[model samples]
Target: MSSSSAPTSGTLTYDQAGVNYDLIDPLKVSAQRAAAATASHLASHGFTEVAASRGESAYVVDVGPFYIASIVECLGSKALVADEMATLTGRSWYDGIAQDTIAMAVNDLITVGATPLVVQAYWAAGGSDWFGDAQRAQSLVAGWKKACEVCNVAWGGGETPALAGIVEGGRIDLAASCTGLINPKERLSVGDRLQAGDAIVLLDSSGIHANGLSLARKLVERLPEGWLTEIDPVNHPGLTYGAALLAPTVLYSPVTEALWQAGIVPHYCANITGHGWRKLLRHPATLTYRIHTVPPVTPVLAFIQQHAQQDDREAYSTLNMGAGFALFMAPEDAQRTVEIAQGLGIGARIAGQVEAGPKQLLIEPLGIRFGDDDLQLR
Candidate 1:
């Protein structure tokens, strides 16, 4: 029998699986170092790179009086989920995948306190025939445009490449990039204001928000019926496993813009996608994140945890579980931040606080502690 407990002899881990970060981490470091070396070239273009923005969610460039934030993010294999759903339910989940792609890009760009201005898409397919289906093509177009509208950004043109040999003939990879403007210059939240007494408010995610789908898809393989398996009726009734997983990601750009407009500036912000909750401490600081209360894990995530049989350490470190975006601000603004997010129709709460100490993430409720060693981005 499988159990979500300690790792025994047959336990599964992310490292043991195909997506090993150990191998990928070094490549990222090498690329970042190479990218940093070219910063001096931007100086001649009348743009200077922000000193500490090299490893941030978005790259910030100083343009005279204002700053610009830019990011490029892929939807990962989440689009594969959409493709599978199309075969099983005969309905394209590309619309949801479109929204996920936008969320993945804009959410990261906003972490630097920039308002997205222009967004572009990258749809790489194995063959041109992939877009031959009218329903899938139209759904992707409409969904991507709708998400851009929610972000209040212009839908700039994008590229659709047909690389028959590189990608599977039936599959397409979705990704996006956007540029944001940080007006007035004082609105930048790049960790300079992040201090010990600040509150950590976490915005909730709408179930598996486009991070660990590569792992989640593997979990489905171990299931009795794979994608066709029904989600727990009591928890997520009337949804197949693929449908529950394909639900559109929650858009957080509007929520952050609302908070900014309210005159509540966060000291730092992080889009909790790739690194899960540990992303709250992405900045290179010696402060500790004391999580007093952990948010309720979403039903879809709960299903993943139970079926995958992972312990808390593995699960929380690998999946967002519930928390999506994080904001570090003064204690006085914590409640109002939650209020602003909730007002924007997004769920949120004050989940933790920053403390003066060695860098670590202490989840008091779950008895889980992640040291700086556990979250090495550099």
Candidate 2:
């Protein structure tokens, strides 16, 4: 057998790798317009007390000692995969995707140092498939309830739509809106407290943690039949490699609560979603996040690397690479942070440290450095 070579189409870009630029562009434009309109409205209404504001996937309203934050997220292409998985495993359709739907919203809030309070999901189903439809709706509610319970959040209820023509058999679109509260004094901001000598804490991820699936599916489609039939060599688990890839995303409430109790405020916290560590460097000044030690390579990630012919750097940049959350803290508080996370039964480790100038990420011993190209979003 011969080895496969990397795609030679000129430094494979993210959009070329299957991220839908056309679909995302309109949404981006609309978001910008909406943000401007909202700001104008607020100003016109004489709401001048608001301290700061920025718009992206969510909006934040500053109110005195605390800030009210909201996030909205939809079940991307993974909804189709979830349907397939459910049919294959004889599980409820919504059962597999509901947790991720909630996590997507709650985690976004957490990245801004907000504590999630209430979660609401909106779902639309179709056809006369009452059995599947009812099961999916019920499973979604149960899943959200379970997630909220674990996160110490409350279920604020939501809307369910039954559209016969708009949705097809076994088809559903799920989305969520979450509200959170954060003390302005305690809110973590980029570059405010982050500095050189600050240690980085990495919280272990359960699996892919709900990003990069479009590329993952493309790669899987090109693979030979029964590629994931065998058990993974690393972390030998009973499930097939593909099955393990479906592991649910890790919830951060426990870790956040632990840090809150320990009074170990992070200088910066990143959810490590879609863009990985790139999201962590959204600060003003030049900064470098040196990841020295990483969580042990899980079987799923190892399989992806080997099969996709991707290097460690590409894998880490594209996926969570085993760490779900990256927290920047003072060197003195590193041990305490790890202890608190561990005490809460969450896997935590010292992944790296911050440094001055040369705004680039370096992986020690390996001598691998990632620059703007590697971290930049297309």
The lDDT values for all models are 0.87, 0.69
Model 1 error, position 251 (Å)? 1.2
Candidate 2 lDDT (Cα, whole model)?
Answer: 0.69
**Candidate 2 off by > 4 Å:** 1-17, 22-30, 43-58, 126-135, 163-168, 188-191, 223-228, 231-237, 376-378
What clash pairs does model 1 have? none
Off by over 4 Å in 1: 1-10
TM-score computed on alpha carbons, candidate 2: 0.86
Predict model 1's lDDT versus the native. Answer: 0.87
lDDT of 2 by residue, 12-42 (tens): 3344456666788788777766666666555
lDDT of 1 by residue, 1-378 (tens): 122332333446565445767778899999989999999998899889997788888999998989988999998889988888899888788888999999999999989889999999999999999899989999999999999999999989999999999988899988999999998788887889999999999999989999888767767767778887887887666777888898888889998889878998889998888767778769999999999977788877887878778788888988898999899999999999999899888899999899999999999888999998888888
User: Best candidate, lDDT-wise?
Assistant: 1
